[model samples]
Target: MQFICLIYNAEDNGPQPGTDEFGPYMQAYADYTQEVQDAGVMVGGEALQPIATATTVSVRDGKTELMDGPFAETKEQLGGYYILDCKDLDEALKYAAKIPDAKYGRVEVRPVMVFD
Candidate 1:
């Protein structure tokens, strides 16, 4: 089974880039990536830029509407995601726990869908 671990956390509360702690924070993620790759479960993953860079698109009445930033304001924003190949949801969740962000943020584990 394949699943995606969606990481969410406060937008402006994380360590600022170029700050002293930022390097270690990024290193922890790198370590986690390496570990998962070594275990042959890592399919793909990446961190996203802030919501400020996002554009929400919607179609209503056959007209396109573009909105800047995310659609709704929330305490936590989608920070990143990791796709994994696991035997079951339980196994995928275990990897989600290993993510450093899980300490302070929330990780939503969802299964992937395939259609023939």
Candidate 2:
């Protein structure tokens, strides 16, 4: 089964670049990525640009509408994601718990849908 682990955290809440904590924080991610890759469960993953760079779009009445940033604000923002191939939800959850952000942030794990 394939699962997507949605990572969420406050944009300014964690270690910032140029800070001592930043290096270890990023290294944690690298370590996690390597672990998953070595385990053969890493399908894909990436960290996203800040929410400030996000653009929301919609189409209504044959017209396109664009809005700056996300459509709504929240305490935590979607920061990144990991797609993993696992035996089942149990295994997926196990991996999700290991995600670095899960310590201070959130990781939502959901199974991928397949269409005929």
Candidate 3:
């Protein structure tokens, strides 16, 4: 089975990039990345740009509309994701819990849907 762990966090809380404050988090995530890769569960993962850089689009009444930010505003924003191959949801959740962001943020584990 395949699972995606969607990471969410408050932009106000985390360390900013390219600063000393970000070092520890970088090391933590790097260690986590290595562990998952070594365990063969990490299929892929990436960190997303901040929500300020996002663009939202919607279509209504045959017209296209554009928004400058995300689809909706919230205290927590979708920060990144990890795709993992696992035996089942239990395994996936276990992996999700290991993500560094899980300490201060949320890791939403969802099984991938297959079409056949």
Each candidate's number of clashing pairs is: 0, 0, 0
Ranking by TM-score: 2, 1, 3
1-116 per-residue lDDT for model 1 (tens digits): 89999999997676768899889988999999999999999999999998999999999999999999888788999989999999999999999999988987899999999676
Give candidate 3's error at residue 36 in angstroms.
1.2
Candidate 3 lDDT score at position 109: 93
Top-scoring candidate (lDDT): 2
Each candidate's TM vs. the true structure?
0.94, 0.95, 0.91
lDDT of each prediction vs. the true structure?
0.92, 0.94, 0.90
Identify the candidate with maximal TM-score: 2
Flag regions of model 3 displaced more than 4 Å: 18-21
Question: Which candidate do you rate higher for lDDT, 1 or 2?
Answer: 2
lDDT (Cα, tens digit) per residue for candidate 3, span 30-66:
9988988999989999999989999999999999999
| Of candidates 3 and 2, the better by TM-score | 2
> How many steric overlaps does candidate 2 have?
0
